[model samples]
Target chain A: MKDTKRQTWMGLLARADAGRVPELLGQAGPSPDFEWLRAPEIGSVMVQGRTGGTGAPFNLGEMTVTRCTLRLSSGEVGHACLKGRRKGDAEAAAVVDALMQTPAETLMRSKVLGPLAEDAARARHCRAAKAAATKVDFFTMVRGED
Target chain B: MYVAVKGGERAIENAHAWLAEERRGDTDVAELDIQQIREQLSLAVNRVMAEGSLHDPDLAALAIKQARGDLIEAIFLIRAYRTTLPRFGTTKPVETAEMACDRRISATFKDVPGGQVLGPTFDYTHRLLDFKLAAEGEPVTAEQRDADPAPVPHVTEFLNRESLIEEAPRDDTPPPDLTREPLELPAARALRLQALSRADEGFTLSMAYSTQRGYARNHAFVGELRVGTVPVEMEIPELGFAVEIGEITLTECETVNQFKGSRTEPPQFTRGYGLVFGHSERKAISMALVDRALRWEELGEDNSGAPAQDAEFVLYHADNIQASGFLEHIKLPHYVDFQSELELVRKMRREANAQTREAAE
Candidate 1:
């Protein structure tokens, strides 16, 4: 797989629910040794937006986010930033991220990333279907010639 | 001759204690719970959320309670609390066109695609005092119906089909945020709308009302007014896709205004847009009117010198928090400044008297 695809899977794994990460990790078998380059820490980022949608950039507001960085014993570095205050989620994500770069890349992809990607896609489809149910197709009747 | 006043700490403490007592008035009556405030005084909570630019109803209710039922103060608390939060990321601009509307109405069309649903409104209610509420009142059951499971199409699309309205160009450029950056002028339409959306409701209402009172009147028709919930989605660069974060209730109003096109163009209908955080239709409609009034320059219309039409004046003064801060700061001690003013006045009067005496001599 391309490096970009690997990075995408790492991101999906990180954002997956903290509780779900362990189950996916268990399915992938024994974990590789890794040292915490940086433990997961919660912080905020200032969110900015353009006026209307195309105007000058302005600070809209801030939201809570958790981020972490780790390095595996095999010399692969990984990082994760997830929405909300989930420290374990960030840590687990960073570990998965590191594993994706090592020899276990294919194993992690099938047992972890693949399932995560599928779950996310399914959730999105469900929401889209719900919203689509409300879709109203409007039509205009033919009036007399102008 | 004013000396610096001191020993205000005790006074302030006593005043706070008294205020707290007042806030929980009448020992016989129970103190108002935050949940009660959130559910019962929902309109006030909506106003706070809209002006505060925060969607958390629980926080808004808490702010309201802390501020002793002062709506503006509650909004102030929400704004202050909002600044401390960490931002995840900005969602793609919410598509109000796809709103799952609970209340939808259009003045321009009687029979719209999704028929007009009044929902809960005070529009038709007579302005009569419900004295029964003065005592313990019976629970009023609401009439229920299965919600219409269809997206209500925008009323403007009809006009667009005939090319009656000016084409709103599709642009995906990010707009400026007023909260993080200082507002610069000759502001664009997007920036002005952002200011109006979070602008003080009373101030925005008056500015919009001014337009209707013949100040840069645009002959506005309420093309559509909708209150509904829209899902917020954010793009994750790692996933190479966007995900739904949550949903928020929003009030959107679009007004079609008569525009007399200039020599270079033909007459066409212009659009005024308003979108607010919660069920705040009045504020949203007011915002739309003010938004249209502010677009005079781009529309090739002559500057009418109206308060609503002046972008800088409207944007700067419309924030209640800023307005109230400056207005209330006068209550603070100003002895030094007042003393200096007194000296200057005395000095000027003495000089004038000496000149008069010299002239008489």
Candidate 2:
């Protein structure tokens, strides 16, 4: 897959619902042999922040994130880092990532990435519409001037 | 001649067992569920999340339940749990300007953009007690209205446009984390705010109140007090673009205080800022006041020897966990020291009596 395509899918996987990842991988079926370079492990990552959007960096806080690494039979390496403690999601994401680097790239994109992207877009749209329903516009009347 | 009291281990064990039984009192009544605490006593959960320096409501609720409604103890439990968690990459500083405000009000200006939205607040409620609420109460349905989509311009910005308020210079330096590093003396404003954010609410509130009572009075007007949710984003190194990681609810406050002018500088309104996790307006406002009081040095004003203006004193005593631990440690064994003191006093008294008798003879 192209770098842009890989980036898109990786972004989708990062934000993807953990439960949905397993269902998508199940539909994609089993892939060629692969070895886990790093099995899915639940841990945390230090969250840092700037003073403002443009200011100097500061340690904001920490958040729980899961990560995994694997290598496919075709010699392509894949890694996944996702928010929260969903081990299965990280594993499935890593497998799909590795598969994306091989001949099965097209198949993986269609089966896993495509559906997840659509779902994500739909969720965003729903939230936007809900927020819009409450949008208000305030206007002031111009007072008489001498 | 005092012998060491033994069997403390068994006594401690028995005491703990009895305490556990007391905690579960009246099994006949339905036990308070964590969910009930999370939903019904949400303010307590918010306090725990704020002072605990963690945002997980469920864990806060669980901590509250475990601590038996002692908010400070719950905060301690959450803080302890927080230390064990791993550090993820930092998010970009949350943009409060873009917050979807549920409550936004300005005391300085009666009419401002994003017209005063008095979201959910207890400010207007009468202090009278409602006997009905003592039992199971009916859910309240609030009247909903469309919120203004236009970004609410801060009240201070209006003053800034005319050079009335002091310009807050933009600095890009990273702030120090009190949780990760030991707090040093003469803290920066950023570090001071971080300490105040999680400091004991009562201590901060009282300190702030002292400033209002003329200890180091800086006449303040609430420029803006807002409660809302702000999206948190993080720059992904590989992607080279920040992505929305999550959103968190926050209470933010900004106060405009009396300006100080000297030969070198023109008089301009100074600002005090406070931001904290969850809807903790009291904590946020108190934090802002204390923050301003502590800014005496930077603002080039003389410190009037106020407790709130004393940075070291405020920071030292603000941590409830530390204060409680030191305060309660007196209950531990002190018999050895007491016995030594007793012997010394007796010897001094005997010597004094002998000296007095010699003088009489």
The candidate that wins on DockQ is 2
Candidate 2, residue B192: CA error in Å? 0.8
Candidate 2 is graded, for docking, as incorrect
My TM-score estimates for the predictions, one after another, are 0.75, 0.80
The weakest ten consecutive residues by lDDT in model 1 chain B span: B141-150
Model 1 lDDT per residue over B1-361, tens place: 5576788899999999999999889989988998899889988988897788766677788999999999999989988987876555676666666666767788988777776667567877898998988999889845444343556678888888888887665667677777767889988776777778789999999999999999988888998888876655556555456544344677878899998798776898888887787789999899889988998888899888988888889999999999999999998888898889999999999999999999999
Q: Cα lDDT for residue A97, model 2?
A: 80
lDDT per residue as tens, model 1, A65-119: 6667788888988777665567777777878878877888888888888898888
What is candidate 1's CA lDDT for residue B332?
A: 82
**RMSD to truth, every model:** 7.0, 4.9
- Quote the lDDT for A102 in model 1: 84
Per-residue CA lDDT of model 2 for A1-146, tens digit only, reads 13566666776777786578778988888756789888887665544433322234444344556777888878988777776667888888888888888888888889988998798767554433344443334578988995
What is the DockQ for all candidates, taken in turn?
0.12, 0.21
